[model samples]
Target: MSKTLTFRHVSYLWDEAKALELAGNEVDLFIYRSNLLGADLRLTNYAGGNTSVKIMETDPLTGQPVPVMWVKGSGGDIGTLTKAGCANLYVDRLHALKSRYRGLEFEDEMVELFNHCLFDPKCATPSIDTPLHGLLPYKHIDHLHPDALIAIAASKDGEAIMKEIWGNQMAWIPWQRPGFDLGLKLEQAVQENPNLRGIILGGHGLFTWGETSYESYINTLEVIEQASEYLEQRYGKKSPVFGGARLENTDEQTRKNRAADLMPTLRGLASSYRRMIGHYTDDARVLEYINSNDLDRLAPKGTSCPDHFLRTKIRPLVLDEPEKLAQKSADELKAYLTGKFEAYRADYAAYYERCKHDNSPAMRDPNPVVILWPTVGMFTFAKDKQTARVAAEFYTNAINVMKGAEAVSEYVGLPEQEAFDIEYWLLEEAKLQRMPKPKSLSGKIAYVTGGTGGIGKAICEALLQEGACIVAVDRNLLDETQTDLRKRYGKDNALSAAIDVTDVATINDSLRQATLQFGGVDIIVNCAGLSISKPLAETTQKDWDILQDVLVKGQFLVSQEAVVILRKQGLGGDIVNIASKNGLVAGPNNVAYGTAKAAQLHMSRLLAAELGPEKIRVNTVNPDAVLRGSKIWEGEWAAGRAKAYGISIEELPAHYAKRTLLNEEILAEDIAKAVRVFVDGSLSKSTGNVLNVDGGVAMAFVR
Candidate 1:
């Protein structure tokens, strides 16, 4: 049999001269370009797909008039069609013509370029799909061969596939020609079934329609999305996972909930390694992946899409134990790459050789996109913070689609060569490029009870990098209008409250005000507790009560209140307690601070475990002698620093940095990065974990 459709070519004419006489004005060319881009992405290798829409105009006297149809004009590839490529024609005449020859052959009509038998000289030729659109009652219609959809349709038992996936919500039409024949079949199908949402054209393409342009577009996509989701679930494939709006205008509560889930795991992992994870809390893929059942599943069947290959790899690198897990993941990646692409290692060789052509540029890291651990699931690999985030996004989306495809059957994606080409292609090179990211805590909502101190400011700025919105609480009042911190972050995102962390009533009221002003708090980085770096020998009973009230009791009251609101909202929230590194490893002079921090750490762990069932994740960051810009850093540290390390007070940070393997100074940004990670998705599976942000100072006892 002859093919149902044939390719054709057409180009646009610069008809800007007719701009003055048009009804409803000329459709913007940019929209057409965007549509073309979307279409190409959906159906690059597929054929026999189409798209159309209808436009309306007012009647002179009747005050209501019939609408005109402007389908994707004939004789052009939708892959490259511009606004000028589409034609508008009379809807009534087109419908009348289609009424006859309802099941005719494709060669019935012959019209000149930009001309129609019923169209006036002023009008363009009706699209070949005019009849199809006219036959349907919807105002807009689109058809495309999305790869994710095709993957399922091309599989065995495709009809059974529709029944299982759509659950009889969709109308399945056998393959038919694209002209009058298909139009008539669609009309009959619709009349036979009034409640049909859209038709799975079967081995051809999908067809979705709506009363409005945008609705039609979204509906068309939604059908494919639902189907793709089903398929991924069975075969274990993922689609583009993380491409959320990263604007300042997103829902604060949702972002905060994400941060809450992400922070503890991130801090725990980074503290263990003295390295940072993701940069932002709302870094798209990280948030979605964290929320995915796939990630939470005991045995995840890998990723859902091809683009995820570069970031998440074909499947998540599952790890239960960090040290052994890292090694196992690396080995598995090497083996998979070796087995799938025999001569492809030569590609890596060629790539490195090519890089050698330029001496200034650094060699690219050969690590795959992400490493997934059992408790600390999903770590991305990037040369810098931004690149790592992009890779994470790609991996998350790809994994989602891949998982969705798996539900239909085994997911066999585009060949390994295609994946390799996309990963190494120069077109995708921009993803690896890094630019200075916006503040890490830019849009994050943080509640800091003791905000005026050295530790509080440092924590605030750290939250700033991950784009967090900060709520700075201090017992002392200051002129809010004079500062740039509140002004730059927006008074809405950053709020200053005068309340003591120890006062339960004041904290309760302050939290309500902060939630109302900033929407809700996601990361509660408690830096308000008191600390006395005194020896255990001289510590008084009164000093211990005061410290515990502020550090331990204060945290409990604050976290419990936040959890109530969080549970009602149905999104997982986070709580980050600022515990001393001494809590994890001991310190000689300071007894109360260490004890309180240790208690705080236990509380975080307990809260994380208890809240796990409720989707609330809590954790603590234990920092070692955060003295640089802190008030405590300036005080008696001169004497204690000398006593502890036999060095001057100025040499403590350097002394601390040297204690770690990486030998990097512990910038407040480092701790903040950990906080963002905990709030991102680095430790998605972790809650009751503690992160040591003290330059790996105490590694004697490992978790």
Candidate 2:
């Protein structure tokens, strides 16, 4: 654990910038330097820090050089600092407005006022720490809650520790929830010590400033390095240890396979709480932390720093005595996880009740973001996978911080009252709740068969945009297609599986896996299908068998498994089968394809009736002439269709578009739209019905 702090930047563009005299002074340098500063999870996980540079810009209206500080925008991560991520604000106005609300602490009103003080109204909302940057006299100001600094900053003896570490170099500003009052407090602290290099907010984070971005960044790192050295010298490896650094002693691959085996149950268990859950267990850091013998004691001892309260809860939920879990049945294991989560939640509620009388915000959800199961490793939950990954990163960093602190002294967590003040502070809570309203299917899980292909990706993407996580099920989709999806939705939100859609065992395992990882399935999209377009006389036995297995048997097996999970969850879900137009109407050379789809369409109506009592709705989406991105039309299939129409392959789309009643070309996206409508339960009461997405093809109507 004797690691060095890395200050590597892949590229700084210093040479080109130097030619223009804006090398280190320009706003873009803040973006570049901020990205580097934010990239280190050890320093700032995800969007945990902010960076800025004070520059004078001529106002378009006033035609005068006004003082402006470019601050990290709210919801913008320093790790991905584009120009748009920085908000320019008039520093004078921000400081001047502070005196008007000197006595009043209005959370929402202060945020509103910050928005109005924007130098450019077109810029994003300014950071809540805007005044901290604006009021400081330094030309460059950067703030981050580095765990090492926070370990001492958040300690019971923090002031003494800091006073000893830096003497009079850094000022100590006692615990203030980040807001207008805190900003003014920082202003007062600076006024008292004009020569101070930086200020450590009590139980909060670090603020370092210098004349240039490089100067500020260097100072930030050096201060942190100094603290790390002191902590290490005082109580690192030399100290007597509690169950020193023991691991599961299994190979990495074996650990991951085992974690995967029980992940669905984990997801299902966490989902039973207040929010949808996503996870990251592939991390070696998380694995090392969880596998350690001291996890149960250290993991639940509250966050090493206050900011982690926003991502991880006050502490993690640890399932002790995991050996017993191995003996339990799948249902038993699920129940065990559920029980542990419930107990954690109940305790959280009690904690909130105990603290809210001291002016905390309304009790947020009691769900713990970090779940530590000894056998299965660590899983971090969020509303979606992207945020879950960030939580995972933060929790992983917490592992290092807490252990590092433990090695120094028994890692003293912030008192419950102080943790509460930081957790429910209106400024932080407002940012958390300021997100856009949830969609109808928001935080719901949807499993889409054939998720890698055109229609499947489209369907999953649409659901994702509306706030749903999709487990795209396909054999090949598990590779590149899944990677692309993870890139779009998030590695946590988009999952992929290679499975036989027709095999009951394979189908069941896929559903269970999704269940454990996403709290059981809420919407199932049956989009996996194939068809042979050979003439009846030319078609062989293999073609018929292939069509029947995927189009009919595959639908039955996957749907059957999904229903079992939904029934157990008691959530009343939706199932939308992607049946073809050929199911309703016969076309030439479509004997195998049509008959199999006919069975699928009939099976939907039958399943709908049987599952109606449980409130699980079943419906069919029949799309026609979807020439673009249809997996069914690959290889000889497209040529065969063109031959059937007596036209060149290139002319087929035009020919098919004209075949529709509306004379418009149908696409996979159109089919995905129909599936979404059904999944959203827009036609909630209507099931066992067929909705066509073929640009108004009259022939495909359910006559």
Candidate 3:
């Protein structure tokens, strides 16, 4: 349950500045929210959470201090507080604090942090968490509450639970108050094992740290989610809504046009989750819920969680058109905003009051989360796509929780002051700062069947140029080929394996080895295929099976293995099936090859639809016949084709080239590019597309 809820990308961010801000704020928020979520949900909240940043303050040569740690501040709520909720305390002070005690005794180290402040006035008090954050040597530190911790905390045999869940792999501590003792205990645990990833705070939360903020954040989320999944499987009831979310982008003209502009912005926002982005406006279920009169009489269920308030606002903008419901909803939203923010109506007055405390600009956009137009239900707004998604997810979860919570207590929220504090926190803003850009496929790994073949080699080169690491699998070890590739790039960038794609064991072994070697595979391009030039009468079952084994079965086997890894990674993937133009058009003599190729195309479509929900993209590329390296030259199949058509092979190239509307011979490179397109952003809305890279062959049959 926790695993499903936790977004795998909670840690990594594309924007370095934002990544820094996100890491810091996330760690702080996880720590703050853990208590509210309890050990179970807090563990779900973050497997581990830590924060740190590299900022210049003064030159070291000039004997000046540098800004070291932006640690979590005390008395901040995870559900609300933003970046400013964290404190920027000196690293040296934290280092000293860790040295002073076996465990973190944060209160005892207050004087050290206060004295080490690089810029603050001497009178200002340091954040209560400064010593805690400082105790670790990591650039980022996070304390998470994994679900297993919570379950153990809730259980009568917590010690048994601890041993069962962690065994000897993790350190455990009894629950304690947030600030001093917990920090000290954690510091002591860290000292005991310098290589420790983190310590489980018994009934409290989990602690994790990383060399970088992103790593810390990701580690935290992963640990928590895993524990949550384990606990939920053991003890949790299935949610009333248990199926996977089928979020399709709406076909509204506004949405379609907006998506065009929105995709790039979102891609730039977060490199991880923003990959091949798609979003739904209002899901069918949500629409139904809004239209149902059943909810109209019932009070509006407030937000699911506090973070959602920034996106969806307190409640969904309800729309049930008996008469003029859309207009009524819009008006209601306006009224609600007017009623909610007292100062929104008198912005000028509020502006004047703020000017007295040293002038800064007023809020940029005063409009809150939800907007409902007449006849139109609701629209949630955020600065970017992630926020919008977060809003929608929260709103959905909140609605369910509200249904049950209302039966017991009114849906009260945190104090407005706390909410406001989170809303405008500068540290939170900083946490959103961007990072030095990573290469296009720095973290991406790919598997290429027939990787030693010419076309396969070209595709591998193309993917490699884009920064992807390749796993090249052929029937025999291509060490020389791999050595050349490695020499061109680096040793860690490519792997070569020997495996028969026809055999299930061989295919599985190849996939397992590739995954174990590279951590995981992302793109699987099935270039390992076979062709037989036998007449229909001469085509034997053995021939058909051979073709299928290398083409159809081979592709399926590779795709299956890749899917499992992709699902585990919680990231979508790309699969490309290289089918020949013979598959699309009629083939006279090559019965088995054509049939297998045609089957491969259909298989691609089926897989695309089946894997769409997993975010795994699938597509096929149909290429015209071509010699291995040809300049208007024909292959044996081209000659066979010419003979079948009563034409000379010499005229075949011109005849076939002219047959296509493009009036050109299709090159292997052209087909490879199309394969790249299936995995690239060439067609944003394309999937299950049998892209014809054939030079106008079968012009009437365009797909």
| Top lDDT hit | 2
Ordered from best to worst lDDT, the candidate numbers read 2, 1, 3
What is candidate 1's lDDT per residue for 394-483, written digit by digit as tens? 554444343334445444443444344444544234334533554434334577767766667666655654566676777764345216
CA-lDDT, candidates in order:
0.55, 0.76, 0.54
Predicted structure 3, TM vs. truth: 0.40
Best by TM-score: 2
Better of 2 and 3 by lDDT: 2
Candidate 3 per-residue lDDT, tens place, 1-703, comes to 0122345423322345544454545444333333333233333332123334434455445678565665444434334334555556556655655455544323444444445653433322344445556665566565533434444443334455556655655677764444555556677877887766666653334666656544555566666555544454542133322122223323455433332222222222222322321123445535433543334433243332334444454333332232432244544633443353334324423533443223223343443344322222334444333344445554543443333222222233333333443444443333333334545555566789888776777777777776677888887548976998889976657778887876777776666655444445678888886566667887789988888888888888878866766664456778888887878777678888888888998899899899888778888887775555532133455555676778887776677788788788876678667766666556646678887877676642655
Let me know the TM-score candidate 2 reaches against the reference structure.
Answer: 0.86
Candidate closer to the true structure by TM-score (higher is better), 2 or 3: 2
**TM-score of each candidate?**
0.38, 0.86, 0.40
lDDT of 2 by residue, 1-703 (tens): 1223453411222333543564635787777678777767667778887888889999889899998889988878888888788888888888888666745447447777887688899998887777778778888888987877777776667787788988888899887666777788788888898878789886678998878766776777777777777766765375444345564546665555566555545555566644465664656656656766677777667775555767888988876534666799877877777788789889999989888855567777787788776645677777766677678777776765665556655566667887886677777777777877767677688999998888888898888877788888887847787788778776667778877887887787777567556656789999997767889899999999998999898999888878776765556789999988888887888798889988999999999999999888999998877778878778778887788778898998899888778899988888888888887758888888899887777777777
Q: Model 3 scores what on Cα lDDT?
A: 0.54
43, model 1: CA deviation in Å?
Answer: 48
